[model samples]
Target: MRAEDEPDLVRVSLAADAVFAGAGVELPPDDPRTLLAHADRVLVATASDGRPCGLAATVAIDGHPHLEQIAVDPAHGRRGVGSALLAAVRAEAAARGHGRITLTTFRDLPWNGPWYTARGFAPLPRPEWGPELVRLWEAEAGIRVRPRIVMAGRPG
Candidate 1:
């Protein structure tokens, strides 16, 4: 991702949040600039017009790759953009010698939990959470009201 792609990725993230809002789920406020600043890698998926339509950002946690955020413009939903972006992240993580990828998401959401499950992720037992993952879960406690779960998958 280029410096110029930040704004478009931010736009896509916020637009995708609207989908959760529409479902009566209120997500914690997030700053895209902060997210990008800490991201180890940002993968962008562009539309046919060459405009960004989705993105996946990753960070390292306990020597493994963790997906910090993934968002797709609702306009481009169900067109494989999200899947492709995830695949790219997984490949990158694998190439970097990371054994697995981890993430947290609303457990009940069709697109949040089930979607990843379909793609090979499984709920991570809390007992397996590392110190960093525990800190992350705690950090999000007050900010997010919806039920969330951590999941992990071997990066293929």
Candidate 2:
């Protein structure tokens, strides 16, 4: 993602959040600027107009690339933009010599857990979690009421 893509990417993410709101999920407000600025790697999918329609952000966890967030504008949903962004992130992780890509998501959300499962991600048993993943799960517990799970997918 380029510096110029920041604003539109932020808007796309916020627009995607409307889905959660409609589902009666009260997600904590996230600052896209902060997310972009701090992400270890970011891949964006853009509309023909050159505005971002989706994005995947990654961070490092125990030497592997962890998908920190992924969002697609509701208008662009079901068009494979999210999948493309995720694929790009996974490719990046593999290129960086990471064997797996990890993420945390709401366990029951159709677009969260099932989507990943269909893409080859599997629930990583809590007992198998690394220190950083455990810390991340604990941190999320304080902010989200919905059940969440950690998932891992081979990037190879």
Give the whole-model CA lDDT for all candidates, comma-separated: 0.90, 0.88
Return the TM-score for each candidate structure.
Answer: 0.96, 0.95
Which pairs clash in model 1? none
Using lDDT as the measure, the top candidate is: 1
Q: How would you encode candidate 2's per-residue C-alpha lDDT over 5-98 as one tens digit per residue?
A: 8989889888988899898889887778887998987888988887889999999988888998899999889999988988888777778788
Query: Model 1: what TM-score?
Result: 0.96
Q: Per-residue lDDT for 11-82 in model 1, tens only?
A: 998999899999998877877888888998898999999999999999988778999988999999999999
- The Cα error of candidate 2 at residue 92, in Å, is 1.4
Those runs of model 2 whose alpha carbons end farther than 4 Å from true positions after fitting are: none
Candidate 1, 10: how far from true, in Å? Answer: 1.1
lDDT value, candidate 1, whole model: 0.90
For model 1 the local lDDT of residue 31 reads: 78
